[model samples]
Target: MQYGAQRVSDINLSQVRKMFEQASPTAINLALGEPDFDTPKHIIDALKNALDEGYTHYSQNKGEVKLRETIVDKLKKDNNINTTADNVILTVGASEALYSTVNALIDPKDDVLIPDPGFLSYREVVKIAGANPVALKTSAENGFNTTLDDVENTVTENTKAMIINSPANPTGSVMPKDEIKAIAEFADENDIIIISDEIYEKIIYDKKHYSFQAYTDNAVTINGFSKAYAMTGLRVGYLSACSEIIDEVLKVHQYNVACIDTATQIAATEALTGPQQCVSDMTSEFRKRRDLVVDSLYDMGVECIRPDGAFYVFFKQDNPDEFIQKALKEDVVLVNGNAFGEMGEGYIRLSYAQSYENLQTAMERLAKIA
Candidate 1:
């Protein structure tokens, strides 16, 4: 079958994502990486207030002035990086930010370096943008942190960018300051764009999250209110890059969806500037679940990285595909790590986004299978 573009072959992760949506008793999804919390009442109220005030209209393609300013303030206060509002581009969510950036940077033949056990979206986004996705292997033995040695082996002249996620998805590993600095320096020297997805920045267990933007001048910092503020439905995420890169991405943005909703922009501003207690509370709860899962996995003789951040556990099994098949029969569904990329083989990514009771029950079910 002929398609308009080769990239059309790209598919969403819906095959595994739909495991829970289908409501199979044989499926207990710890697959999707979504915040289980309800959107804070105050943030919801802010949207209602915007509706009452007739804030509905086509917003600026780059987003509203106030929201951009709020995002700028957030970057300075939280990440300790000074960024101007003009350098930021608001997209539907981090997903769109990632797509837009990859599209803007790559030609049909370009290659993008990605972490092995990364967010499932990275490769799909790269392929959809008409680029080749190259997996740079990072292992559980190495704490799933990307080393300069691993990346140096992967980079070539055709490499256009590198996608980095810390407080990373699936693995839940947070790269330290020294490693981030080394990667940033490498990107700078190689003239490759670094797309840092910091969406899970706030869900850390013990250590503070580090933004790659803090270490380099050549990286794009991708963030959103979805994970941190429990505003997943709002679909408001923004990217902070150099003005040159931001301009090119906005060109792609204007052609494909035009812009985000005005009311969501207003609500997002309130999320950044208003009370932050919700984020703190959510992080505390996630930590508790992380502890429970980590302890349980250890007891089961399943080796997992001691995740410093994020609500996930990337645990190894003797044979991941076989174990996942058996686990589904045991009525505790999880994503086979190989679904993310080839380097993700022999692993299973279990999201701790469910309640403690559900996690405990799921663990017990897996134990029975063991």
Candidate 2:
């Protein structure tokens, strides 16, 4: 008897996790995109205080009122998105927010536009929702930003939604403000709902993040404290949209995860309302690491675009599979670009979220093969 559903069987484990698990014990990991920083003292203290103050119980299904209110202000001030707590749903993480939004809005056989060589979850989530994920292929020559032409060429009458990620995963490319507004306008005109992933917004260097909802009312914005606050384990994230959309997504959130826990919500509220120096410091350090990786690759005559944000460098190679094998042999683990999507072939993504000393050593090791 078949035990698993066809959708479950169709999806394989992500290659990013596969490589990380299979790498040699001695290998320097540049595979996962997780930040190496510890959660800030203030946030940690808030969590402790919340637990001590009896905040261990279940929160509102949507989330704590304070955190939701803080997120509303954040959206207005930082993202230029005007929203209310009633239009927000706190989620398990950006992962759940993405999953819930896709499942709630996308119908079976509907087409969803996703960037090729984009976040791996975007395609998988759409597939899990029984939707067709149309690839909007981006190339290194174009700085890996999804363009108006790409959307125009690929979108069809069946296209119901699109996902856009700035300071994108694997490639670390950020979309320009003018381009963002243009795409948002086109999506609005075409009646395609935009799902904007801004998980990496605060990690950016020298680039500004433009929220899709800022330009269009028909949009869902997903963000979290994971990357920015190094709170991956806390599992706190949120989604904001018009009440019509949020109302539906809340149904999914209620069933999947009733609440994100009061302690974490209190801590997340602190993460937003407390001192922001921690965020600035982390971003400053990431910028230095990014430069080190880019310079090392350049010195080796490797081909790559200097990323404007995020902590990854997706460099081109002639034989990415063989290159990955050689890199593993050199005790420096890297992910093959094909893991992201078909357009990612012939590339390898290197994460620079490790210590400067470790990155220095990894660069030395990669130099031998480059």
Candidate 3:
């Protein structure tokens, strides 16, 4: 008997995982983009302290009061977005925040503009919500920057929201400030809701992150500790919006996970309020890795756009599918661009989150494949 919902069935299998089942145990995995660093000791200590103080119970449905307050200060100070604790809802991760936002904002057949070659989760979340995902095709020629013209031309009457990821995934390019300003203006005029996924904001290189929420009250800003603090295991993230949006999203957030764990919340709070040296050190290392990967790739005669932010390098080569298959034969893992979206075809994304030594080894493996 066919019992499951069609919407769930409609979601495609992950491209990032296509060869995962077949991958050799010894493969040098450059496919996943998680930071290789450990969570700082201070953050861990905060979690321990919270647990010792009997913080195991459920927090407010929105999240812990202290965490929300920290997030409010963070938004104002780091992102230049003025918001209050009432506007933020802590979630399991940015994944949950994005999903809850999509669920709260979209109905079946509603169109949501998501960047092609964007984060793997974006399309899946929209599809699972029974919403139509309209691909905002970005290109390598333009440094993969999503332009205002791109969004303006693609909007349909059915369009309700647009997802913008600076330091975008699969490309590793940050949107220029002008593009962000233009898109913000267009969004304002068109009444389109903006979902700015700034999870990588803290990992940027040589550029300041311009949060769309800074430009419009209609924006929902989603961020988490997974990337910045090496706290992926903690599973804490959050979203900030005007009260109306927060209220609606909290209804879904409340039912989906109710609240994040008390200890995790405390750790996340420390991640924000503690000395930020860990973040600086992690970014400095990531920058070194990025340079090593780019320089090494060039030396190997492979062409790639030097990423402005995040810990990935995205580039294209001839016969990428065959190249990917052959690379796997050598036990070096790389994600095909098509795995991200159509606009991503003929390209590949490799994470530089590993050590310079491991990356050099992987680059050597890539040389043989090329």
Candidate 4:
């Protein structure tokens, strides 16, 4: 009676979404990942202007030329990645960028290395591509950043690719530059491709975000405006790689997405070329929220590392499932650590992307149960 394809028969809905859906309407949600900020005024104005200018049609399958060119300059100036417009593919969001890249490169039965407590999508996408996902177990002792040793322990002759996320989801740990370079060099030596998710690059605090592509030609960089510019609904993101990879990835993108919305692509152009004070201001505010949440958890006698980047605080709980249930009873929603991976079993991730006022209230509510 199942109508679904066998390829997706084993895939489950995101646990993050399940928590969000089951929470009471009055619950303080810390389960979702998107920033709480409204899209900046300038970008909103640009979207409106684009619509007025009749940009309602499909863009080139590669995305709007202007957006791609802007992304090219951004890669050079911000990421030190000297890629061209032809090497970029604008996707629906970083989600699409991740999916398309995995589908384009991974083959059935191939082994792909992913962080143990990594983003859920990485494992699901690899499975969807009919590949095996090898976990590179990271730990709190290591700030949850994947090390070269972690790579060495998990890699096999069947390993074809690896996915790395800095300022990683669930954990919010930013990988150090030296560690990233070490892994990049290791990948180079082994002839493995690297898929670096830098969607959180701009949300970093007290650290610089390094693009893996900067360390190796055998890397695909996935990023978007969703986190940085509060453009999640607009669904505009892009991937940059060598032209050869781009030529292949384009086939998956062209059929699956055709092109991103023309108006949103135009708006994305403005998000890059326009003033960036909005981005800095948002990061500064997130810094304040991050401190509040971390300090509050510590005050409640819970141990957790201060995240170097991103707006999440993954803290240890002896029974994360029980803790999550207790949190829900107190009207404060959180995601269980096990949702990320086996290594995440004793921890829970709390997103501080909400308003400072809301975070304060949520923390107070959590303190009641902690």
Candidate 5:
């Protein structure tokens, strides 16, 4: 009579969203990964026009063809991925893409290597697929960089895949090209499938994103419109790999949502091909916020590492739980880094998604605890 699947019981909501829900009404949230910007008017306009033009119906089961084509072109131009529209499957968001692809590729008891202090969704999805989630430990001492040695030690006959996030959530550490090459080389030698999550690719500061797809035919590149285009609510994201792999993922994607909303697909097409200045403007502002928060951490004398990309700052705490409690008292919402993984125990993740003014106020409150 007990109906809930054991996997559903194990997977909790993301700590970022949980913390936001728990915060006092007056709290300035520096926890969630959501960008605090409104979706650009052009994208919204495209959606409205799409609706007026009669795009309210369901699209192809794999997704809207035009949107998938745009994704193919974007992948070719921006990420150096050479793939056709047939290989791209649009999904609800990167969240859905990740879940579906993991399900498609992993068998029960297979080990999927994930970075400790990586994105919140990686482990849970692997668990949902009935795989053993293995952690690849990364440290602030090395810029939180994932190296070949760390990956090598973790690989084994049971290793089936690895979920890599550049401009990672929580930590905001961008994996470097050399490190990526090493990973690519290793995965090739061992036949490990690499799932590259490049959701934060466009928000990086002064660094070009190098996709693992560029280095391996076996890699799956997952990205979305939410982070870069400020279209989070639209729920547009896609997964790209070889046609063979995409064929399998499409089975799962098709049955789940069947298809993305037609108008949203049109909006996503506009996001990829439209004027790109908005993305530049947003990332420029994020760079400023990144600098502002990192500088504030230094000013407060907290031991912190400057996150290279994305909009988070990672600060070490001897007791992250106690530190989080203290920060809550200051009315500054913060997430214990342990929410990321066990290796994240001594740290806390502070996202800079708020405005310069709000971040300044949050910093002022956090400084009281410092």
Candidate 6:
């Protein structure tokens, strides 16, 4: 059969979702990267109240006006990013926000730099956008932190953008502010756009998150309510960039998904402005889980950096694929590390989004492995 676009073929499937789908009734799941906590009750009530208030019409392509305004207010207050409503675009999720940004910026034959062992979706999205996905290697040796030198070596004349994640998925490693500043400066010097995915900004355990746009003007900051407010089902996220880039991405979004669900937008607005106590509470619990998981892994001779933020623990195993398989057989479903990228061969990602009881049970099972 004559195939679909070659770029379509290049998009690999997501290992995290696949592993999550196969989590048996008897399995202890640490494969998903969402909070186990319930969505803050007020946020849920806001959505219901919106529905009751006849908010069923299609919102503006960007999002509900109030939500966009809320994003502007929250960005300025939380991250020191002075984005206006014109500079923000809301999408179904951060995944869609990422897709829109990638599709908007990348051109045929251009190159995009993504961290090796980074978000599994980055490489595929770059390929599908018809850009070469260049992997910059990071390692457990340095707590999975990518250095400026590592980023510099990967840059080329054809390089159009770089995607960065703090409190990074799989590893939960927050990029240091100095490193983030250096990268922002480097991107500014090269006239490259930086795609900063800060979805876990509110879930940080040990350190504060510094926005890339705080250090430089050349960045698109992506964040969502899913990770922070346990609103994964709401499917609401947003991107903030300079107005010029926002205008460009808005076009791509208009052609794809015209707008996010109206109720979700209202709910997300409440999530940003309502009681932030839920965010603080869940993150504190995650910090406790981080300690428990890291301590357990160390006791089992599995070396890993204690993540200063986020709820994941990426650790080395004897043979990651084999270890994951065995763990599944033992009713502990963990994502295989290589699923993230080539540099993740001996590593496995453990999410502490599950209950402490579940995480402790999984850790005990892992420790008993021969």
Best by lDDT: 4
In TM-score terms, candidate 1 sits at 0.95
Worst 10-residue stretch by lDDT in candidate 1?
A: 14-23
Model 6 Cα displacement at 294 (Å)?
0.8
Across 1-370, the per-residue lDDT of candidate 2 in tens digits comes to 9998887677767889999998888889999999999999999999999999999888899998889999999999999999899899999989999999999999997999998999999999999998899998998889999889889998999999999899799789999888889988998898899999999999898888888899999899999999999999998999999999998998888898888878999999999999999999999999999999999999999999999888899999999988888989999989999988999999999999999999999999999999
**Cα-based lDDT at residue 31, candidate 6:** 90
lDDT of 3 by residue, 138-252 (tens): 8888989899878988899999999989978878789877888888889999889999999999899988789888888889999999999999889999999999899899888
Q: Evaluate candidate 1 by giving its C-alpha RMSD to the native, one decimal.
A: 1.7
Residue 361, model 5, lDDT: 93
TM-score of each: 0.95, 0.99, 0.98, 0.99, 0.98, 0.97
Error of 1 at 43 (Å): 0.4
User: Residue 131, candidate 3: how far off, in angstroms?
Assistant: 1.0
Candidate 6, residues 68-138: lDDT per residue as tens digits?
89988888888998878878899989999999999998897899999888998899888888889998888
Model 2's TM-score against the true structure: 0.99
- Quote the lDDT for 171 in model 4: 92
10 residues in a row with least lDDT, candidate 2: 4-13
lDDT of 4 by residue, 1-370 (tens): 9898898999878999999998999999999998999999999999999999999998899998888999999999998999899999999999999999999999997999998898999999999999999998999999999999999999999999999999799898999889989998998999899999999999999999888899898999999999999999999999999988898899999999799899999899999999999999999999999999999999999999999988899999988888899999999899988899988998898999999999999999999989
- How many clashing residue pairs appear in each of the predictions shown? 0, 0, 0, 0, 0, 0
The lDDT for every candidate, in the order shown, is 0.85, 0.92, 0.89, 0.93, 0.89, 0.88
lDDT score of model 2?
A: 0.92
Off by over 4 Å in 1: 1-4, 10-15, 21-27
- What does the lDDT come to for candidate 3? 0.89
TM-score of 4: 0.99
